[model samples]
Each structure stands twice: as structure tokens, then as C-alpha cells.
Target: MRWDGVHIAATGVWLPGRLSAEEAVAAGAYDADEHAANRIVSVAAAETEADGGPSAPEMAVRAARTALRRAGAAAERVSAVFHSHVWFQGADMWTPASYVADRTAGSGVPAFGLQQSCNAGVSSLELGARHLEVGGAVLLTTADRFSGPSFDRWRCERGLVYGDAGTALVLSSVGGFARLLSTSTAVDNSLEAISRPASPVADPSEARRPLDLSALADDYVRANGDPRRLTLRTAQVADASVRQALADADTRMEDVSRVVLNATGRSRMRWQLELQLGLNEKMSNWEFCSEAGHLGAGDHFAGLDDLVRSGQVLPGDRVLLVGGGTGYSCTSAVVEITESAHRPE
Candidate 1:
């Protein structure tokens, strides 16, 4: 799955506005003392191209525009679109995958979307890179709004961390950015219950639909408990995927100058790399999620953007991109830096 001559051409991110963790709790987003309280994480409070709701096609399009501009590609020039599924409490599935295509003006680039919760961003890019190998540019965009009514909305505090944002990466075989090098995927369906959305927005009967976590508390607890079975399985699968991805790229972890782990926060931040991935404690410096918040499916891309913009990355350095989804799907991508672009970093 590795490629020696591949590289990433550009990365762009769009954040609507900040919603402090305290403000979110004051507004009654979640319990004051709950572990997973939706205490403000990063939220896109402005006018998103997608409008921050179910079927957020416009939002996805906006992110795409930024990324394409970064890579100097025009919307009309894009041939394919890959997006991560969006979640808004009480709304679901009304918009089809084709919705993104329509907003991009059906400019001939087909569209596909992933609803794999957290893992959707990486998975979408993996597929988009494959399209790039065919000698064309592929637009890969990820957008999420955890501010919706769903209890799965982001949670945070001084003791916790959260966030929201959208990201766009222009991937192509033409030139620029980091080469995708390789991607690895591992699945443990046994841990499937760890996270999920109970009902689609289409369900007409209110009773047939789950309006809030009040009714599904039991299910949520069983699925995401303190003794998180998903966390353990994720560690195993993610570690395996990282090793394999690096091996595919003919590299090693020590060789990875930059590592982006899903939003590093209080509870999970300190030991996330060591306890979960069996890695050394030094990686805490590059953690991106917590400061960025959970970002729904936008986790990895946003983190990657930060790295590029901060001048934290350098040419010839290998970057590790990793994370997972609700179904326990995890992925690792190895990228080699080639351009500076002055990204701040």
C-alpha cells in the first residue's frame, strides 16, 4: 500500500467559531458532572457551506473549495468528490450521496460519503488517493458539526477536551503535497456496539425514533462504558494498522518525524499513545484532537492541517495519520513531506 514517489499536495481547514466548554454546559448541552458531557469542544458557529445539519452538502463544498484553492485546483476542474457523513440530532439520510455532487455543480465529479463516525475522514482520503493514482486530482473533504441535538455531540472541560471543524485535502497524482505512500485498515466488528446512531431522521413516528439520550442511556452506557471495550480493541487494531502502514512504506515509527493522534484531551491524552498504542510518551507534543475537539469524522484531517500550517512538518519527514470509527474500523496512513508552502510551519 506504500508508494515511494507519492506526496500530499495541499491541506485546508474551516472552523466556524469557538464555543467554550463552559458556555456549552451553561446552555444545557450536557450534564455538568457527566464523564462524556458535551462541554464545548470546537464548534463551527458561523454560516457553514453545509449549514451545520444533516446532509450538510454546502458545508462540505466550502471545505472542498478551500482545499482546492490551496492546491490551486478549481471546482470545475475536480473529477471526483469524497466526503465524510454528517450527523445532526433528529435529522438523517434525507440527503443522498449525490447531494454533494449536485452542490459541486455535478461538474462530472461523482461523489461518495462515509458514515463511519470518527474513521470516516481517513477512510475517505484512502479511497480518494486511489482515484488519484489514475492520473487525476481527487477532492477529499470532511465536515462535521457536533453541536447538534444528539448526545453524541462533543463534550469537554478543564478536565476534558472537545472541538468541531471541517477539512479539505486536494489529492492527486499531478504534483505537490505529500505522497499517500500507503494506508492500512483493521476491523474488529466484535466491538461494534461502542458507538452508533440509533435511528435515521426518516423515521416518521416520534416514538419509533430516538429523540435524545434520555431514552437510550442504557444502550449508550452498554456501548460506551468506563471500561471501554472499544478503546482496548481500538488500541490493538490501530497499533497493527500503524505498523503495517509504515512497513508498507518501508519505514518505522522512530522515522516518523510527525504523528497526529485523534484530538488529544485530558482523560485520554496523557496515556493515549502509551497505554493505547504501546508507544513512548513523547508523542503528546503532536496530539491534535482535544485542542481540535472530537471533530466527529473530521479528526485526522484537521490535525494534519495544523501540522502543515504550523511549520511543524518538514521535507523528507514521514508523517503518521491514524484513527478509527464506531464500527471499530481503524486506519494508518504514512505520508512523506516534500513541500514547505510556508504553511506557518
Candidate 2:
């Protein structure tokens, strides 16, 4: 949706140390041939909380603290906290969003959790922008760690590697560093089954099986006919989302200084980015994303943080962020940097 007077005051990202593809192959955690084919350099791996490391919510807390501090946003000024994630957040049937809000914005503001799959980050941003229409600031945070028995970061899905990260963006209706020009979303719900198993698990034993997106995708294609049909439809939807976002922002593809997309591997990146959106690889944050791997909902926020911190995008440069999730939904947003900020040392 097109918006006015909504600005991104600051962004923060907490990324753990890297786990190189070579090390993963040597440890038999990754296949060398697959690594070569996907062309991923490394992925961010988080230390387990059982080993005295921060859990997913703690990571989100860290990122939120940084963003709050950077934006000079006080507790009373924040209207709500919106947290998003993909994997289990340390416990079952607990509210991680409340925890994030308690630690960052105090207990006064209401907390919400969004589950829009990988698109939840940008989607939350879109929602938060609307919340600003009612007045106070909104904090958007996303965190995920792909480390557990239920998921194999390297093998859970084909042409993709999962990474662990926490990201936060503070949006204010008052003023900030960048102006949020517009946001748009498109959905093709028929494609949701592409990530669902043909048969739902009936037993507890069956439910614990590791996620195998490749098998699920195969099942969908086998049942629905050709896979190309899925690809074509996805591309068309994403293209329309992008076109509308740019149009709403009164900006063109050629006018954008950068594009940030999901942190998928090389082949899928080529298809969705260059071939589909017609954005040059250099103009996109593919290099940084390849090294960090797919960071669930943290992809867009972390990428934009990197661009600002690294000085890759200057003031007045417009940035386009495109995100898609397993629900077969796509969200695109346009942001225009209004001024420079002090880069953390």
C-alpha cells in the first residue's frame, strides 16, 4: 500500500559467526557437489542456548535494543512491537513478541507476532507503517535459527541454505533517516501446497520428521502437472507486486539504487532477480546474501542494514525490497533514504 509520513528511523541486525561451506563439507554436513551447484559461500550459524548462547528471542532483543538506541526512541514512544520468525522460538505455546517488547519497549506497548512466512519482515514493516497512521512509533523485529533436529539448514530445501539472524527496524511517523514511499503485496494461494506434504501427519512420530521441501515440491508438481507452471505464475505475481510498488512510490526500476531480495542461492537468485525483475546482480545485495544464506524473515531488514552500515547506498538513493514466502505470497516495498546516519564502528 502507498504510504506518507512513515519513515524508517534505523535498522539493526545481529548475525552470528559464519560457517563456511568448505567446513560443512569436511564435517559431512554439506554436499560438495550441491555447494558447487548452489554457489553459496557460507551461512550464519548461531550457537545453541543450551551451550550458553543466546536463544532466538534473545537475539531479537539484542537487535531491537540496537535499533531503539539508534533511533533514539524511548519506551513510551513505541506503540507496539511486532516479531516474526519461521522456526520454534525456544519454547512452545509462549509469546516471544511479549518478551521482545518487555526487553526493548517495556510492558506498556502491546506486542504482536506475525506469521507470514519469510515475507513477514517486510510484511510487518507494511503493517507497522499503517499502525503509524494512528500515531506513535512501531518496532518490527524478525529472528530465526535453523539449528535443530527438525531442520537441516543445508538440506531442508533445494537451491537454498538457511542462516540464523535477528533483525529490527524502527518506524516513526515523526521523522527519520529514510522515507517509506510505498509497499505492495500479491498472492497466489493455489501454490501454497507446493511446500505441504501430500498427507498430513497423524502420529507424533511422523510429525518429527525433518523438513524436506524438495520432496514436498515434488509431490505438488507430480499431482498438479508441470513445475514450470508454478514458476511462471510466481514470476508473474512478483513482477506485478514490484511494478505496483514502484508505481506507488513514483519511482521506476532504473531509478532505484539498490534491490534487496530473499537470500536464496545463485540459480534461484538469477531467476527471481535478474531474469524476473530485470535488476542487475550488482545493483542487488546478492553477494552479501549469498554469504549469509537465507535468513528467514530477516533477509530484507538485514540486507538494508548492511547497505546503510557499509555505505553502499547514499542519501537520496531509493531501495526496493522484494520478499516471498512459502505461502505463495510476495511483498515489495520502496524506501528512499533521506539523510545519512552514524555507522557503528
Q: Pick the candidate with the highest lDDT.
A: 2
Error of 1 at 306 (Å): 1.1
Off by over 4 Å in 2: 74-76, 203-205
For 1-345, candidate 1 gives per-residue lDDT tens digits of 765444466777777656555565678864566435322244444433366443245556666667766776433356777777546522465544456566653645687766776788887767776776666677777765554333344332223344446677777766776778888888888665443345544554444332343334346566567645545666788878888998998887778886766654545655666665556645543344433566667767777777777777877877888877657788889888788766431
Worst 10 residues of 1 by lDDT: 150-159
Evaluate candidate 2 by giving its C-alpha RMSD to the native, one decimal.
Answer: 1.3
Clash numbers, per candidate: 31, 1
TM-score (all chains, Cα) for each model: 0.80, 0.97
Candidate 1 yields a Cα-based lDDT of 0.63
Q: Report the Cα lDDT for candidate 2.
A: 0.89
Clashes by residue pair, model 2: 1-183
Best by TM-score: 2
